[model samples]
Target chain A: MSDHAVSRRAFLRAGGAVLTGTLASTSGVLALIAPSTSWALELEALDAHQGATVLQFTRHVFPHDRLDDAVYALVVKDLDAGAAEDPTTRRMLIDAVRRLDEASGGEWLSRSAAEQFVQVQAMEATPFFVKVHSTAVVSLYDNDMAFAHFGYPGRKGDPGYIHRGFNDLHWLPDPPDGASGPVPETA
Target chain B: MDMYDNRTTFAADDDGVVVVIGSGAGGGTLANELAQKGVDVVLLEAGGLHTTDEFIADEWPSFSQLAWTDTRTTMGDWRVARDFPNLPAWICKAVGGTTVHWAGASLRIEPHEFRARSTYGDLAGATLRDWPLSADDLASYYDTAEKKLNVTRTNGLPGLPANNNFKVMHAGATRLGYETCHTGRMAINSVNKDGRNHCMQRGFCFQGCRYAAKWSTLYTEIPAALQTGRVELRTRVHVARIDHDDNDRVTGVVYFDADGRERRQAARVAAVAGNSIETPRLLLNSESSRFPNGLANGSDQVGRNYMRHTTGTVWGVFDKPVEMYKGTTMAGIVQDEARHDPKRGFVGGYEMETISLGLPFMAAFFNPGGWGRGFTEAMEQYRHMAGMWLVGEDMPQADNRVTLSSEARDAFGLPVANVHYTDHANDVAMREHAYTRGAAIYEAAGATRTYRTPPYPSTHNLGTCRMSERAADGVCNGHGQSHELANLFISDGSQFTTSAAENPTLTIVTLAIRQADYIAERMRARAI
Candidate 1:
């Protein structure tokens, strides 16, 4: 069990106010909102409980401390859309939450974060978990929020990094001068 | 540049024109060189044309925009077949083919690599054969190719400045007592020349260079060929089969246009350059009564001896940040390992090139189906990581091949190519040694951790329709002409007799240039 899972569980225990829209305000609706971020999503096929479990499962799979719940929400948003269109996918996710609840002695969301981690780990190789894990791997890291958090400055603006310190490494000792050697002639 | 002649279309019965089936490093350059010799050519590309401006900076989107996402299958015990079962080779289908996605490391094949069978001797289960021509035969052509591509470290062009990734590799290689490390000979321009802009170090070499700094046939050869007014470039045209006459000589090609309408274009000469897999697939699908097995497959060697270089990735994590993706995707090299020595437990050698993957690609490919804290912790240190790619000659096995799949049929109702491969013993030893050396380099450079990643989908595909001097030994002759059919030619890496330790683009282009001269001379003598 990671610290992130514990903190996320602590936020959810406080009357679930962290997820405000359609989660805290409305009842019996499938929706979620990131704790500190302004990102929110509504599921068309999955229930509120199923959607929340998918979010929790994605975070447990990738579990980065610096990333907000919003990054994991991106995975939930995609999985929810997939569930909305495909009945097979919807059933798979619904069955996934049911199994998780059973594994956690019924009502997975109310279980301790450590127990939830064990439950997710036990089902990591299942088709339902594989779908969520694979989708989360791409959706979590490819976006802007993950880029900023991971310190990957993807694609500099305008003319690229030609003049913007492409070779600025001050930590290591520099190599001997002309270490690249001379140019070969075509003739 | 108004490079495409959209208003022009060759007639179905135009037998005087040479039809090139694929627009890529081989076909594109061959078409332009042939047109320069007053020959008419029809360059057919399976994918649509994407100009430089349309190229995106992102990874997944660029892959979708350029990759050859055809319905193909893979078999055998290779890692690619297990990791990426559907995608065996990472070549492109667009106008420029894989050249659009290449990292621009243009290296010439070493002299000894051309005579692999003779120098390395016969090893068990390895179907090694010496090339029909030596490096001396290709030296002039290589010179021409280097100048045409405006490759750095040649023609007095300066090498690219050492980026952070290169600095890490240089320091590590120097510490390891490897003296042949450098910024490498890359096709990406270090200065503005040849009407193309210099490299901006944009770090997306595999996703189509947006500034035209890296040489791609999409902007260089195809456009130049179209400007000759003797060439017709067609896009979104999928070639299905090569048609032959009663004499067993190739006469035309059958293809499906963008609208899925079947069209036939007659040709005096038909050159196949659809990379290794499809080149053999097209020939096998064109089986006729005169040539029952396949066109030019007299020895039944149309799709055997498949080789994708023994490759793997190594990433070193350090306390200090090494922003790898801040410059060219592949910017440096250590050439000392690229020499044959049987004492090293491998018949051939490998090169260690500096490589960088953006965050999206890294997550997707670092370890497919990898997760947990062990995986995320390494990825979390993305800013502090430096990467290198190990590419070496993998011995060709007769059973490792690309055959027609009976299960998977493409959109054009043609059976797709099923690529089957298994790593040979030499390949396994070479990769293991390279991994140990790569890890040692990182450890010498004060690394905290190192990850030896399995090879990604093959970007260095070679040897399916191979060349040979004897007709009974292989498919094509020294000039890439079909041993049985004088009018048929193979103008791609498919004609490689043996896989070399160097990159194949420069060699493929060199062969295409030499083939063009042979084709022109034969046409003048009324040979075909």
Candidate 2:
């Protein structure tokens, strides 16, 4: 098992009070104090503050040329669910977020993307970093949106790639004649 | 054609049927061949019968649908143990087995590979042995298998067009002054044949071909066997143990149905083709008072001598985008290095085959726990990567074995298989040589950077239940029959005497085709 294989039961028990306290200021208060307000109270696994931290953390881990926050949010959704289920993951994320804030001189969430990127890089070897990075690597690029954004011709169905861009290599120089020629019709 | 679903129950006392325990290349092909010969066969597959339509082109979801994600423990000093301990072998659980997830690299083992012990001489700490039957004995069977699979570049079918990945490899191989670089002889269709569609070059060959262009038994052999009306394929029937009679001959199989109910299907002759891992695990778990050491395991080699090919991947970063994931996962090969050259510091040789993984898989497997600028930069150049996989002949060590784990129990409460492996000195040397050569090939082709990835979870599992001329040497005989029990047979890659450099699927299919004839003859003669 990986080091991130945290005890879900232990985490839920130990952090139950902390999670309730965190939610009290956000969703709990929104429900009691401003139930009829124009703002819809969004119920998420992670608190608004933690969710913001993770979204920023994921983008820094896998910063692309043109990837936006919407793309990185896909990863946050999974992490939020994971933190909800496994208290260890929740605690880890909370602790890591606090440490990042301290490392950024108490301006992690308010700091520039460049400063936040350095903080994430400094803690690359941490379990929180590994868990989030590994999770985001798959969650971020596995969608149809990511494929289109990266210009990857997603899986071929129906007609297949034979008549498509299977052999269309206009970007490359032509090889020797026989290199791309028809295969010999013999054993 | 008669196809029975798991819902259709079979009687526990019906002992007249020939029961095959898997439905991949070995079991599926064997069932079809036996059915063609007017024999009654009941093929039991542990997974559902997922058709081509159910195949998702996406990597992770397809993996969830196709991969055998059973709880199998991994031990020893091998890299896979550290990186992918839960998934030791990347085989499929679906009806077609691993064939559905294969890259379709159809290659015959070289003649010298069949005589590994005699040709390579003695090596320290290696349990090398020559196959009981030579390549000459299997020539006709290979020819038949090639025709059955409709392998490209054979039977008047042209090869697949070279993709950009292949073009990169071709330029590198040419610069290295090595010939024989071409679109490989793949089981994937280059043109329409056998009522299946031609190669679409969909690039997700590992994720199950949606077009049925790849020769998977799910779409090919299993369907053909069903058409014969002499075979019954029951999916989601996981065999737990093989039952033997008083004389220690396998009489039937006891398995769990899809609903987790225990059921027994009696057999006249039971052939175990549940791959190398589960095949030996089933036999070992079948230990009775008569066969105390497990059925046909008197030589103590039933689960010993497990061999996965010496494998790694080398990726080249070019200035221009390669778009490697546009064609078939693997379509080209450089066979120049697949020769017996002891001077290269390793007794056996390897093949450099073109391979491409989608960005999702590449990120997960490129460097398992990698991060930072180096890792992020690689992903940034995902479209500019050209990669090739190195598959070499790894020495089979006695210590590198598969045993029943007393600690980890599977979903069925049965003890899961514990795969333990340590790289032999020969394997280490071979990998080092291949890495250097691979990096040089990329450099010669103007690659700015080349990254050598460590070995991932094995797909080419072989040589757990090997064939030997003498009963004392191995678990099975030349015809894949258990040496101790006449009615029991070992199918799949487990019957390989030595792990050859070539992909084992082609040979496994050929052996199954040949074994069907031998089994039919024995049944006729009443040899047992």
Candidate 3:
């Protein structure tokens, strides 16, 4: 497939899955888990239960309507490796997950979205929360896959952005006469 | 086009050549100017030469590729130290230095700004001094530098087209009855000239302009100097210290090559331009029995009065999708507030320039440790954000300086430079005023919400080994030649006597062009 075509397909899938996930929890969980299963199974740092908690935690930190489990999984993979190397990071992640469950009365995953959000909020300023939030912010948003979801056409190179949407602003009124004009093509 | 003489071999005893350390705006421009005057120069740059083809357009990746990222320590009450401890200055560790990563805002120092001491008067807790050289002394040189860099809005080149972020800024400025809003006078080209392409508006000005539209010394001065056949650019040669003779005259530079092997390049005259941090550190490290306090540091002011511009960003969320990241990173500016008005609770002034950060950087810097719903909402409204950066004159404080950290050691086992900064009362007041005015402008343009961000890692590092008329006041003289050592010169912003309310690159290049003329004249006269 062409590069644009592949990006379009990913865009469509990301839109459908994330929108469905937002509307209903059961369907949302299924939609999130389907494409992310292979990556989830490859977790080296966290066990299945801990990985699931981390996945949920990342979504809360960034929490976009269009973001999918795959974007969050990028954060999970990095965190997993970090935890594997550092004993402090490993202990923080495991303990944070346990605390969330205890706070939610063992309904951390099945609880209402509002309740789970509150549990995450209570863990704010904690080392575990800060670690997860900081890592996920970069890993989740810094990916090309996530860029597609947000409608960010990453990096226009080669035949640059000049003749493209760079100057196209339909929302803005036309600039005052002589303030700006179309760039003359150079020979 | 033999535009490179990558000298792999230079004898240690070659003292006839002039050695310039740090090939950025200052050193690069100076090297080219001196070479054109038939002077042989050995330009030693600590970083690798990454050409335009190696530049990526992404934020994080480009930062990794371009940022200094050396093992430096930060010990200041400033937010940058707390948020970004390791990366103190956002300069480049490449051939062109920070010019490779700058946003191409080229501005001249205002007439009054050259004499901050006379204009602002003696303020408490500030070390303000009038530049020994005035704006008039540098005006002709600024013109020359502008022509060399192809700075737009001059020499008949048109200003850049206004992008969405600029449009938003214009709309707001017009609504607020502020008149001086326009696409800025940038060094980035509006038309192809001097064997370089016009800007393609790739919106990655900070990530190394691949189009070569934005003038960087890496592509412009460095190549031009080499083509003269009088310049040799030695990249990845980190200068450790400036060596001087018993007479306290600079004789050579001791450096580490790409293989971590110690090498010495003898020089008749040595010019240091390794930014503010490293420049002072080098002088301090080069202490000898003759000048124990550091060479040419008789004033004991080698690393004093460090100043980064008082900077912050305010992002305005509008009802419409501004799509701020579609054009040049910072093309538009509102200069209405740049006038010095002490009645507004600040001693100095600031410029409100339209700025845009990519999604990844915006998330990291919007609030350093920010998370939760508010942060998420800002990220979700990324498409609807219009941002403006406030670049203003910050006070020069003796206590806020770059000092050699006794604890931290760099890769070469040398004491790493520790930057310590505290926002002066003047700086704090100026920032508050700028924030208020910035938010008001966006609000006038119908912004639904606005968020203020603290200062990020500074790209504009200035004033550590500043120029002074008196030897006891600063390190260098008006001509950038060291006060105590005639053959030693400072060719970077480190020689700035006072931080002005303008971007420092143009002034740095202007000073370098002027310094080269003086160096050539002095060589003929045998003044040293």
Q: Which one wins on TM-score? A: 1
TM-score of each: 0.94, 0.90, 0.93
Instruction: Write model 3 residue lDDT over B66-143, tens digit each, in one string.
Output: 889988888879988988898888899899998998898999999999889999999899999999999899989999
- Chain A TM value for model 2: 0.68
| Model 1: lDDT to the true structure | 0.87
**Which regions of candidate 1 deviate over 4 angstroms?**
A1-36, A181-187, B6-8
Give the interface RMSD of candidate 2.
3.6
DockQ top scorer: 3
Ranking by lDDT: 1, 3, 2
Give one digit per residue, the lDDT tens place, for model 2 in B278-389.
9999999999988888889999998888999999999999988788887888969888889999999999899999999886788789988776568777777778889999
**lDDT for each candidate structure:** 0.87, 0.83, 0.85
> What does candidate 1's lDDT look like per residue over B1-528, in tens digits?
465664356788999999998999999999999999999999999989988898888898989999988878999999889878999988898999999999999999999999999999999999999999999999999999999999888988888878889889888889989998888899988887878888887888888999999999999998888888888998899999999888877889999999999999999999999999999999999988888888889899999999999999999999999989887888899999999999999898999999999999999899988887888998899999999999999999999999999889999889999999999999999999999999888888888999989999888889998999889878999899999999999999999999999989999999999999999999999998
Clashing pairs in 1: none
Docking quality (DockQ) for each candidate: 0.33, 0.30, 0.37
Q: Is candidate 2 or candidate 3 better by TM-score?
A: 3
Ranking by DockQ: 3, 1, 2
Q: Is the docking of candidate 2 incorrect, acceptable, medium or high quality?
A: acceptable
